[model samples]
Target: MAIQRILAEETVSVTEMRKHPTDFFTDHPIAILNKNQTAGYMVGKELFETMVDLIRQLQPQESFTATFQPSVTHLKAVTKGSAEFLVKANKEELGDFVE
Candidate 1:
């Protein structure tokens, strides 16, 4: 379910991207696409890093566990393999990673 939501959000963003003609970036559609993709990728990676840091600091002495709704424009949860957190949205709910 969570994955579906995330994908849906990504789809919506892509749809919006389609609506906006690639003419603003000096009429370079390819450049605009590449820039958007890079921006999204970097933002997701940065968010994951920040969350990991926060969890380490706030729960340094114990195992960290929590579910949060991020203010992400498109991407959804990025788990470091936790089996205890269950995210629900579309029709799928997965347990934390079990190792």
Candidate 2:
């Protein structure tokens, strides 16, 4: 199945739970897991920015990898001319979402 189709199905399941509160309660564990996953997707941008800011402040000497979507704009903003972190784009890892 396509990634978009899989995401849409997950979204539909969540929406069904919201429409039926009793079902949400019955499937509370699944709901919680779904909520956590959704929350990550919602805060992805903010999370990335905060992580980059913290890394900058700490200025760790060790090299690390921060993987993100193959978009250059935010990566450039975070690692532009930075000797500590190097931003690399792997288009093959982008899947079908790449433009």
Candidate 3:
């Protein structure tokens, strides 16, 4: 038998999820299971967006430029001499597109 980690506080079987999809979502992350094994997570829209924002913040500043500013586009350092310019964006206005 193999042990698996459950990342979410709630667990929902695939069968139950299929039977009632909306019942599983409650603005919190839920672990989706298949045959007692972990399959994936059922995350609400708000939670998903929050996760994305956290990921962006956790990214190494020296490695790559941040991608949030409208005027400044951040690109990956492709070549040895490739460079990146970062423009500050309002962290409060996450999940919103730039004008």
Candidate 4:
């Protein structure tokens, strides 16, 4: 059998999680193991959100030009470069559907 390496500081088995699902939430990520193999890491909702925010902060920001669609359902914005992104319509633009 090959040796499995786990990078997490804490490890929990699937059986334990099934026994007590709420017991595993922590400020740090926990590595979930299956059959003594690394499966995935689980983190608290707040921690996961913070990680996502940190990732977004690390990415370079780009200047973009906004263009609204006639139907108000979609808005496409193009960066100063060749990149393009789609933004959801605002509440007012989306009208009663959002509220």
| Candidate-wise lDDT, in order | 0.39, 0.45, 0.76, 0.73
Model 4 CA deviation exceeding 4 Å by range: 1-3, 62-99
Where does model 1 exceed 4 Å of error?
A: 1-14, 17-42, 64-99
Candidate 2 residue lDDT tens string, 39-97 = 21222345557767897878766866677676788778767755233235455644464
| TM-scores of the models, in the order given | 0.22, 0.21, 0.57, 0.56
**Candidate ranking (lDDT, best to worst):** 3, 4, 2, 1
Q: Which stretches of candidate 3 lie over 4 Å from their true place?
A: 62-99
RMSD of 4: 13.3
Q: Cα-based RMSD of the predictions, in order?
A: 17.3, 15.3, 14.1, 13.3
Instruction: Encode model 1's per-residue lDDT on 1-99: one tens digit a residue.
Output: 132112112222444545764422221112222323422311234455776698788875767466865665433334522322543322345335433
Per-residue lDDT of 73 in model 1: 41
lDDT of 3 by residue, 1-99 (tens): 778999989999999999988877668889999999989988877888998889889988776755765432333333322322113435563346544
Clash count list over all predictions:
5, 0, 0, 0
3 against 4, candidate with superior TM-score:
3
What order do you get sorting by TM-score, best first? 3, 4, 1, 2
Over 1-99, each residue of candidate 4 has an lDDT whose tens digit, in order, gives 877777779999988878987778778889898888888888888898999888778777883435844543332323422232114556575567622
Scored by Cα lDDT, where does model 4 land?
Answer: 0.73
